[model samples]
Target: MLRVGVLVSGGGTNLQAILDAMDQGKITNAEVAAVISNNPGAYALERARNHGIPAECISPKDFPDRASFNEALVAKVDSYDLDLVVLAGFLVKIPEAMIAKYRNKIINIHPSLIPSFCGVGYYGLKVHEAALARGVKLTGATVHFVDEGMDSGPILLQKAVEVKPGDTPELLQRRVMEEAEWVILPRAIDMIANGQI
Candidate 1:
């Protein structure tokens, strides 16, 4: 089985989708071995607990520097025998060391189509807001490999959603998330498993 690890910093909606996909056999050879979060109160940890999956918290504040924190995080991931690391909603800027360690083994799901409303300081509802302000006719989610640059990794998959007139950020977010959790994420995982990535 391909052991997967997830990192999250908020509600585990995407993590839940992954679990559902696993339960339905939509992802054939992967299992989430652990879920790690920087915040102890993040609900993603609770979601993992509820599913009987091991969960952990490793805060950057606990370490002296970014490198130290990343070293600890990498250690925790390694303990789980993780083959792939999925960043669902993790907020931290991953250290270059970690990127070097995991390389293409790490993947992240972004709220926007990327290279548009992505990069530092663009996350969550902020991405949707930027897209709306630009009067974009279409916007969606992207799943990409994790690299040293911010959200500049090679795209694994992308799903587009039509931007409706008079759409609120909330509405667009809801629609984008639906496609993200159901389609883009699963397809990316399948590609990795099948060596098509």
Candidate 2:
């Protein structure tokens, strides 16, 4: 099995999609080994528990320093013996050492199609807000290999969603997530698991 460890910081809607896909056998060669979140209150942890997967919270605040927290994060991820690490709405910037160690093994789901409303300061609803502010007719999501730079990784998959008139940032974000993020992320995981990527 392709063991996967997922990191998240929020409601984990994307995480739920992955779990649902796996339960439906859309991803046959993979199993979610664990779910780790920076927020103790993150529903993702609850979701993981509900599925009987190992769940943990390793917030930076719990450690005395960022370096310690980073090291702990690395160790925690390492403990799972994961073949893949998925950042599904994980807000933390991965530590340099972790990035170096994991290299192409890490992948992230960016809210935008990338090279657009991506990079630093463009996350969550902020991405949709920027797209709406710029009056872009099309905005989407990207699943990419995680690199040292923010959303600068090599692209794996992308799917665009239409921007409707009178759409608020929240509405647009939901649409993009449902139409693109939810679709391509699972597909990317399956591709990797099946050695098709």
Candidate 3:
């Protein structure tokens, strides 16, 4: 079995989706070994705990600088002996060192279809807001390898959702999450774990 480590900083809906898939046997080769969150109060931590998965919160504020924070995160991740790292709603910029260490072993799910409303300053509801403001007829999700650049990694999978008339950012975000983000992330994880990537 492949040991997977998840990184998150929010409600962890995507993380929940992956966990559910695991429970349903959709992902047979990988198991979530641990969850790490930058926010101590992140609900993702609670979700992991409810499922009996090891979870930790390591604040970047506890460190003196970005490098030290990254080093600590790398140490935490290394402790799990993970075969894959999945960033599900993790908002921090991964340090170059961690990127070098994991290479293509790390994957992230972007809210937008990527190369679209993605890259710097485009995360969470901001992505949906931009898409609705631009009046795009369709917006969706992107699963990709995590690299040094901001969401500039090679694409793994994408699924588009209709923008819908008069859709608010909140509504669109939910649709994208339910219709796209929740679907492809686990598929990508399964693909990676099964050596199909």
Candidate 4:
């Protein structure tokens, strides 16, 4: 069985989906070993706690800079002896060193289909806002390996959500989460665990 670690910054809606999948027995060969968050108040931590999973808060502010913080984060994750690391709504850019160590072992769920509404500054509602501004008819989510570049990794799974008429970024974001991100993220994890990716 694969032991997975989750990283988050805000509400762990995707993390919740993964736990639900495990509960439903969809992912039979993997368990959530731990959950870590940069935001101490992240609801993801609460969800992990509810399930009796180890939840940790490692604040970047505790460290002096990005390198130090990434070092600390990598140490904590590596300590778990994880088979895979999933970034679910984790806002911070993972450092190159961590990416080098984990390589394809780390994966992240993006708010939109990559090469579309992605890159350094594209996250959260900003991605949806960009899609809406471009008047796109369809936008969705992507799950991919975490590399040194931002959202630039081998695509694993993708799911599309319709861009409804007169939709706001908030609405699109929610729909995409429910329709795309939440769905494909778990599927991607299971695939990796099964060596399908």
Least lDDT summed over 10 consecutive residues: which range in candidate 1? Answer: 179-188
List, residue by residue over 57-100, the lDDT tens digit for candidate 1.
99998999888898898788879888899999899888787789
* TM-scores for the candidates: 0.95, 0.99, 0.98, 0.97
RMSD of 2: 0.5
Q: Residue 181 of candidate 4: its Cα lDDT?
A: 87
| Candidate 3, RMSD to the unseen true structure | 0.7
Instruction: For candidate 2, write residues 1-197 as lDDT tens digits.
Output: 89999999998999999999999999879999999999999999999999999999999999999999999999999999999999999999999899999989999999888899999999998999999999999999999999999999899999999999999999999999999999999999999999998
Q: Which of 2 and 4 is the better model by lDDT? A: 2
Question: Over 4 Å off in model 4, which ranges?
Answer: none
Return the top candidate by TM-score. Answer: 2
Pick the lDDT winner.
2
Candidate 1 residue-pair clash tally: 0
Cα RMSD (Å) per model? Answer: 1.2, 0.5, 0.7, 0.9
By summed lDDT, which 10 consecutive residues of candidate 4 come out lowest? 188-197
Q: Which stretches of candidate 1 lie over 4 Å from their true place?
A: none
In order, the Cα lDDT scores of the candidates are: 0.88, 0.95, 0.94, 0.92
Q: What's the residue-level lDDT of 53 in candidate 3?
A: 98
Higher-scoring candidate on TM-score, 2 or 4: 2
Candidate 3 lDDT over 2-108, as tens digits, reads: 89999999899999999999999888899999999999999999999999999999899889998899999999999999999999999899888889999999999
Model 4 TM-score is: 0.97
